[model samples]
Target: MIHFTPKFYLIGRVTHTGTQRDGTPFSQVWKTIDSLGSGTYGDVVLQELQGSPGGGCLHAVKSITKKAHKNNKKILTNELKALIAVKKHPTKVVTFHGWYQDSQQTMFIAMEYVSGGSLERYMRKLKRVENILISSTSPLLVKICDFGIAKSADIDASGLKT
Candidate 1:
């Protein structure tokens, strides 16, 4: 039987693009740069994707400690399903690379790291500017994402049910 894994994300992510000469997957090493935000459920961090500097790869890794809540796993599973549902529209939604569970059972969701600064920060800058407008050629679209209760019982790290 084929195995199906589940992926979870609330933003964009990076995936392994190639294998090594020995036919083994090249291991990825993620280094945390800073903390973006945190909440009752988990914390988001700015991570630098090492060994691929030229790719301009950076990811926001959201880590939810197993002790965060009693149903943390279930909530994350639902989030994963919602992420998968929007995978086709990556420009509007965050791309999900994948997730990992450490030995401590802390779930880490890998996503794209937006570097233009937070919306709030951008707004403040706009207020100070004499004239700020969206270019007709490139309109800015601010979206509020909402994913209702969703969960996938059969999902994991090895593979996801696309």
Candidate 2:
């Protein structure tokens, strides 16, 4: 049978790609560099794909749980769809690259790494004109990263998944 093992992000030892997580197959992964922040569910790790198509570019790894409310299929579908929609935008939001799962059903979101500063940091550096006034010329541009509990959009929207 084609065993579709579930995977979620975790906070522990992750073997390099090619090894199986709990039984699911993950080829290999390099060490994490930065912390991209965490949510109620899981955390994010920053790393680089060694010798990838473009010779080792950076990537963001979102480690979430398969045991979460929506399950893997739902989460994957939503993220894939969102990525398709936002890929063309020239913003600071991370670009969706791909996904992986482990035998125990842990999922990880792989996306393009952003070299620019984060939204929080950008906002902090902005100068407040007054207590009631907010600066309109602040460099911190915010982009909404929207994902719902359900698969909000259709898969294959960008035709990249096929």
The lDDT per prediction is 0.54, 0.52
Q: What would the per-residue lDDT of candidate 2 be over residues 1-162, giving only the tens digit for each residue?
A: 112223323354343444333665644435566786766556777776445444356766777776664476766666656665666763634456666677666667676665443445545664431111112225644433334422556555443332
Off by over 4 Å in 2: 1-29, 51-56, 70-72, 90-93, 124-162
Q: Provide the TM-score for each candidate, comma-separated.
A: 0.61, 0.56
Best-fitting candidate, scored by lDDT: 1
The number of clashing residue pairs in each candidate reads: 11, 17
**Deviation (Å) of 3 in candidate 2:** 15
The window of 10 residues in a row where model 1 has the poorest summed lDDT is 128-137
Q: How close to the true structure is residue 151 of candidate 2, measured as C-alpha lDDT?
A: 52
Please report the TM-score between candidate 1 and the true structure: 0.61
